[model samples]
Target chain A: MTGSRRQRVAKAVFLHAAALVVVFLMAFPLYGLLLTSLQPESVIRSRELSIIPQTLYFEHFRAVLAEGHIVPLRRALVNSTTVSALTAVLCLLVGLPAAYALSRLRVPGRNVILGALVSVYFLPTTIFLIPMFVLLVRWGIDDTVFSLVLAYTGFILPFVIWILKTFIDRLPLQIEEAARIDGCSHWQVMIRIVLPMARPGVLAAFVFAFILSWVEFLTPLIFTSSLRMTTVALGMFRSTIDIQVGQQAAAAVLTLLPVALLMLVCQRLITQVLMSGADK
Target chain B: MQAVPDSPAIGGQDEWTRAPGTLRRRETAFSLSLVAPALILVAGIYLYPAVYTLILSFARFDMAALEIGRWVGLGNYKALFANAAFVDAIWRTIYFGLLIAVGATVSGFLIALLLNEEFYGRTLLRVVVVLPWAVPPVVAGVLWGQMFHADVGFVNALLFRIGLIENYRIWFGDGRTALHIIALAEVWKAIPFMVLFMLAGLQSLPPQLHEAAAVDGATAWQRFRHIVFPLMLPIIIPLMLIQFVWAMKAFDTIFVLTRGGPAGQTTTLNYFVYVEGFQSFDMGRASAAAYSLLVVTLGVVLMVTVLRRYAALRKATA
Candidate 1:
C-alpha cells in the first residue's frame, strides 16, 4: 500500500511538473511584456537579461500615458472604450431579438439564414473592407468612431446572434408558455421571462463583443487616420514603428489591462459560453 | 386533445391548446418582425458590400467617384493569376494556414489532455491559458517580436548563455524565418481557443468508458486511441475547420511583424488584398483578389463538410 501510494504521489508530481511547463510557455510572453514594461530601458537593453525582473520602473508607463507620446493613449483608451461599449450595446439590441425569433419562432428560410450567418462569421473582413471603406467614405463617416462601431457590429453581430440563440435554445419553453398564459404578448414574454433567464448568456455575449471590438486592429487601422482618432491597438502599432520599445511595451500592457480584467471577471461565464458554442 | 368553446380564455391555456393555424401565422409574423432589424443590419453591412465587391471585382473601380468605372470581365482575375508574385502569395497563405492549423491543433490537444488530469493548481493553469487569447493579435506580435528581437531579446540572451548559438540572430529580417515566427504568434493566440474547445470535448466524454477500459488492462495510450479520440472527432473536426479559416484571416500579426517584408516572403493573400486595395489603390484587382480568398475559404468549408459526412457514413456502416 505504501509503495502504491508513493507511486501515486510521483505520478501527481509528474503531472504537476508537466502542467507548470505548459503554463510557463503560455504565460512567458505576458511575463516578458510586463517585465519589459516595468524595467528601465537600460535594464531591458542590458546584455545579461534575467528571467525575473528586479526593478520597478514607471517611466515608460508615465511616458506612454502623457500627451503626444505616440498619440495620447489615454484618449485612445476612451475612444476604444466608447466604441466597444457602443458596439456591445448595438449587438445586444440587434442580436437579442433575432436570436429569440430564431430559437423560439420559426423564421422563414431559417436554415438558409443560419448557414449564411455562419459563413459571414468565418469570412475574413478583407472581403468587406474595400466596399465598406468606400461606403463609409461616401457617407462621410469613415474616420469617426461611429464608423468603427458600425463595422465592428457588422462582423460581431453574427457571433452575438449565434451565441444568444444557443442560450435561448437551452431555455425551457414551459416558462415562456407560462408567461403567455399570464396574458403576456410575445415581446412581453421575451422581455420579461426569457431575457431574465438568459442574463448570464447576455452578459457573456456583451463582454465578448466588447473584447472583440477592443482588440480589433485592421478595421481601425484602415478606417481612421490621425493619432487622436486611433485606438489603443493602432496607437500601440504606431508606437512600435517609432521604435519606442519601452513605451510600446507599456502601451501593450495598458492595451491588455481592460481585456485582462474582463477575462478575470467573466472567466467562468466566458468558459460556459465557449463550451456551449463549441457544442453548436 | 379536443379544442372546446367551453375552455376558459382567462388562463390563456386555450390560446396555446387552440388550433395551431392562426397562432402559427401570428408567430411567424412576430418572428419575422423580431428578425427584421438584424436582417437589415446584416444585409446593409455584409450582403450589400459583398455584392458590390463582387461586381467591383469584374469592373474598374473609380477612386475619385468611388464607383464602378467600366466593366472589365475577368480582366482583373487574369491579371492576378498572371502575376507570379500574386500566385506565390496564394500558395504561401495556404502553407502558413496549414502550419497554424496543425500547430494549434496538436498543441491544443496536448495541453487539453494535460489539463484534463486531476492536479493541483489546474484552475490557475486554465485561467492563465486565456491570457494569450485575450491579447490582441497586434500586441501579441509586438510581444513575440520583442522576445525574438535581433538584439536585447531574451531568446538571444538565453540561447547565447546555453551555447545554442554564438550570436544573436535576426529572426524577422530573414524571409525564411519571418513567416514561421508570425505563425508561432498566431498559434499562441489560437491555442487557448482550441484548448477551450478541446477541453470541453474531453470533459464531455463519459468516465465509465475510460474506467472500463482500465479494468480491461488497456494502457492509457491504448484507451485514448480507442475511446477518447473517436468520441472527440465531432468537436475536433468543426473546430479545425474554423481554425483554418481563422488562420487564413490572420493578418495583424503579419502586418505588425514583417509588413510583408524581406522581399515579400511573408505576404499572404489577406495582406495582399489589403495592400492592393488600400496602399496600391487598385481596387479592381484587390476586389478580385478578395473574392479569390473568399472562394478558397468557402471551398475549404465545403470540402471539410463533405469529408465529415463521408467519415460519418463510413463509421455508421462499420
Candidate 2:
C-alpha cells in the first residue's frame, strides 16, 4: 500500500515537471522576443545572450513608434486597427442577416450555400490572390486600406456568418415566433428578438473577425504599398529585412497587444470558434 | 402552407395581409435578399476570381497587354511539371506538411495528455500554451527567426555555451535546415490548436473506463495503447488532416524566415505561386500552380471525408 501511494506521488511530481517544461518551451520564444526588445543594443548585439535584461532600452520603441519613419509603426498600427475594425464591422453588418436567414428562415439551397462557404473558408487563399490583386489594382483601390477592408471582409465573412449561424441555431424559436405574432417583421424579429439572445455569439464573431484581420499578412502585403499603408504584420516583416531586430521585436510586441487583450476577454468564445473547425 | 401572420412593422400592412401566396413570396424574397449580399460577396470575390484563375491556367497571359492572349490548353501546367524547381517545390511542400502533421500532432498529444493529468497551474499552462496561436504567423516567424539568429540568437548562444557547436552557424543559409526551421515555426503555432482539440477529446472521455482499466491492473502505457489511443483516433485523424492542409498552404512564416530561399530550397507550392505570379509575373504558370494546389487541398478534403466514412462503417460492423 505504501509503495503504491509513493508511486502515485512520484507520478504527480513527474507530471507537474513535464507540464512546466512544456509551458516553458512553448512560452520561451515569446518571452525572448520581449526580452530582446527591451535590452539595450549592446546586449542585443552581443555574442553572448542572457534571458534577463541587463539594462532597459527605449530607443527601439521610440524609433519604431516615431512618425514618418520607414514602415512607420504608428501608421501601421492605425491602418491595422482601421482595417481590422472595418472588417469586423462589415462582417457583422453583412453576416448577421445572412446568418439569421440561414439559421432561422428556410432559405432556398441553404445547405448548398453553407457548404460553399465552408469550402471557400477551407480553400487556399492563394487561389484568390492573383485575381484579387489584379482586380483591386484595376479598380484603382489596390494601395488603399479600404481595399484591404474589402478583401478582408470577403475573406472573414464566411467564418463570421457560420459562427453567427451556429449561435442563432441555439436560440429558442418561441421568442421569434412570439415576436412575429406580435406584428414584428422578419427583420424586426431578427433585430429585436434573436439579436439580443445571441449577443455572446455576436461578440465572439466580431472579435474573431477582428483578430483574423489584424494578424493577416498575405493580403496586406500583396495589396498595399507605401509606408503609411503598411500593416503591423508587414511592418514587422520588413523591419526584419532591414535588420532592426530590436525594433522588429518591439513592433511584434506592440502588434500582439490588442490580440492578447481580445483573447483575454473572449478566450473561451474564440476557442469554441477555433475548435468548431474554422482552421485558424 | 403556414398562415401569413401579421407584420405591421413592415411598411405595407396591405402587403402583409394580402393574398397568402404574395405574403409568403415576399417573405421568401426577404430571406433571399438578406442572404444576397453575403452570397454576392462570396461569388464576386471568391468564386469569380477562382473561376477566372482556373480559366487563366490554360491560357497564355500577355503581361504587357494585361490580358489573356490565347488558350494554351495545359501549356502552363506542362511547364510547371517540366520545371525541376517546381517539381522540387511540390515534393518539398509535401515533406514540410508531413513534418508539421507528425510533429505538431505528436507533441500536441503528449502535452495534452500531460495537462489532462491533475496538476497545479494546469489552467495557466493551457493559457500559456495558446499564446503562440494568438501570435500572427508572420510574427511567429519573427520570433523564431530572432531566436535562431546567427549573431545574437538564443539558440546559438545557448548551444555554444552548452558545447553543442564550436561556432554560431547560420541556420537559415542552408536549404534543409531552413525548411526545418520554418516547419518548426509552423508546428509551434499549430500545436495549440491540436492540443485544444485533443484536450476536448480527452476531457469528454468517460472517466469510468480508465478507472475500470486501472482496476484490471493495466499499466499506463498499456491502457493508453489499448483504449485511449483508439478512442482518440477519430479526433486525431481529422485534426492531422487539417494540420496537413494548413502546412501545405504555409507561406507567411516561410516568407519572413527565408523568402523561399537560401537559393529557393525551402519554397513550397504556395510560395512558388507567389513568386511566379507577383515576382516573375508568369501569370499563366502561377494560375496553373495555384489550381494544382487547390486540387491537392481538395484531394486531402476528400480523403478525410472518405476516411471518416470508412471509420464509421467499420465501427458499425464491429
Candidate 3:
C-alpha cells in the first residue's frame, strides 16, 4: 500500500513538472513577440536580448493605426470580415443541403461522395493556387474578393458537409418523418424542423468556416492584389516586409485576438466539434 | 394477403401506381435539388481546375500562350525528370516531411502524456498548449523568421549573451542550416495539432487498465510499454499517417520564412510547383510536378488507410 502511494505521488510530481515546462515552452514565443512589440525601437534593435521589456511603448499601437502604410489597416479589417462572413454563409448555403442528403436520403453514391469529400481535406492549397489563379483570370474575377470567397467555399465546403453530415446523422429522424406526415414539403421539413434541431452543428460549421477563411493566407496571397481585397493575414505580410515590426506585432495581435476570443467563448462547442470523429 | 385491396375499378389502381411513381420522382427531384449547388461548386472550382491542370501538363503551355497551347505530350514530365533542380527539390521535400512529421508526433505525444495527468493548473496549461495552434501559420512563420534573424533576432542575441557562442550565427542564410531551421518551424507550428489529437486519444483510455496494471506490480515503464502503448496504437497510427501527409504538403511556413532560399536548399515539391507555375510561368512543367505530388500523396494515403483498417480488424478479432 505504501509503495503504491509513493508511486502515485511520484507520478503526480513528474507530471506537474513536465506540464510546467511544456506550458512555458508553448507561451514563450508569444511572450517574446509581445515583449518585442512593447519595447522601444532602439531596445528592440539592440544587440543584447532582454527577457523583459525595459520600457513599455503603447505608442507603437497608435503609430500603426495612424501610419496607414501599404494598405490601410481599417480596409484590411473590413475586407477580412466581409470575406469571412460571406465565406461562412456560402459554406452553409452549399453544405446544408448536401449534408442533409447524405444524412437522410440513403442516396446512391453517398459513400463515394463522403470519401471524395474527405480526400479534399488532404489537398494542399499551394498546388491549387496557380491553376485557381488562371481559372479566376479566365473567369475575369482575378484580384477580386469574389474569387477569394469562391475559393474558400470550394475549399471548405467538403469538410463542412462532412462534419454537418455526421452531426445530422446523430440527430433523431422522427422529427423529419413527422413533419413529412403532416403534409409538409421537403424544404419545409429541412428549414423548419431539421435545421432548428441541428443549430449547434450549423453554428459549429459556420465558426470553423469563418475562422478558416479569416486566417487563410495562401489563397488571398495568390489571388488578390489590390487594397480593396487584401485580408488581414495578407495585410500583415505586406506591412511587415517594410520593417514595421511594432506595427506588425500590433496587427498580428489584432488579427489573432478575435479568433482567440471566439475560441474561448465557444470553447466547449469547438472542443466537441474537434473531438468528434469528423475529419479535420 | 391483401389482394382484396386491388379494387382498380374504383380508381384505386391509377392512384396506387401514379402516387408511388410521383413519390419516387419527387424524392429524386429533392435529392438532386439538395445536391445541385454543392456539386456545381465542386465541379466548377475543384474538379475543373484539377482536370485542367492534368490536361495542361501534357501541353506546351506558357504565360505567353495565354491559355492557348499546343499539345506536347510527355515533354513536360520528361523535362521535370531531367531537371536537377526539380530532383533536388523533391528530395529535400521528402526529407523535410519525414523530419517534421516524426519530430512533431513524438514530441506531441510526450507532451500529451504529461498533460493527461492530474496536475496543478491543468486547464491553464491545456490552453497554453493550444496557443501555438491558434496563431496563424503566417504569423508563426514570421515570428520564427524574426526570432532567427542574425543580428536582431533574440535567439542569437540570447546565445551570445549567455556566452554559448562567440559569434552571431546566420541561421536562415546558410544552406545547411536553412532547411533544418525551416523544418523546426514546421514542427513547432504542427506540434500543437498533433498534441490536440493525441490528447483526445489519451483521454479516451480507460483508467481501470492502468489501475489494474499497477495492482499487478507492473513498473511504470512496463505498464506504459505493455498496456498503454498497445492500446494507443489504434489512434497513434492514424494520427501519424495523417500528419505525414500534412507534412508532405506543407508550404505556407516554408514560403514565408525561407522561400526555398540559400540556393533552393529548402525548396519542397510544393514550392517547386509554385515557382514553376507562378514565377517562371511554365505551366506545363508545373502541372507535371503537381501531378507527381498528387500521386505520391495518394499513395501514402492509400497505404496508411489500409494499415489502419488492418490494425482495426486485428483489434476486433483479438
Per-residue C-alpha lDDT of model 1 across residues B1-318, encoded as one tens digit per residue: 111111122236666677777777777788899999988998888999888889999999999998889999999999999999899998898888888888999899999998999988988898888679878887898899899988778888999999999988998888879999999999999999899889988998999999999999999889989999988877787777788899999988998899998899999999999999999999999999999988887887798799889988998999
lDDT, candidate 2, A170-190, per-residue tens: 667777877676778788888
B47-165: candidate 2 lDDT, tens digit per residue? 99999999989998787767888999979999999999999987888788889999999999999998798878888998888889888888899899999998879999999999999
Error of 3 at A52 (Å): 3.0
**What DockQ does predicted model 3 obtain?**
0.44
Model 3 lDDT per residue over B51-144, tens place: 7888888987756546837899999999998999888887777677778878888988998888777777888888888877778777777778
lDDT of each: 0.87, 0.85, 0.78
> Candidate 2 lDDT (Cα, whole model)?
0.85
Candidate 3 positional error at B287, Å: 0.9
lDDT of 3 at A184: 72
Report the C-alpha lDDT of model 1 over A2-104, residue by residue, as the tens digit. Answer: 9989989998999989888888889998899988899888888888867777779999999888876755798999999999999999999999999988887
**Candidate 1: global Cα-lDDT?**
0.87
Give the DockQ-based CAPRI class for model 2. medium
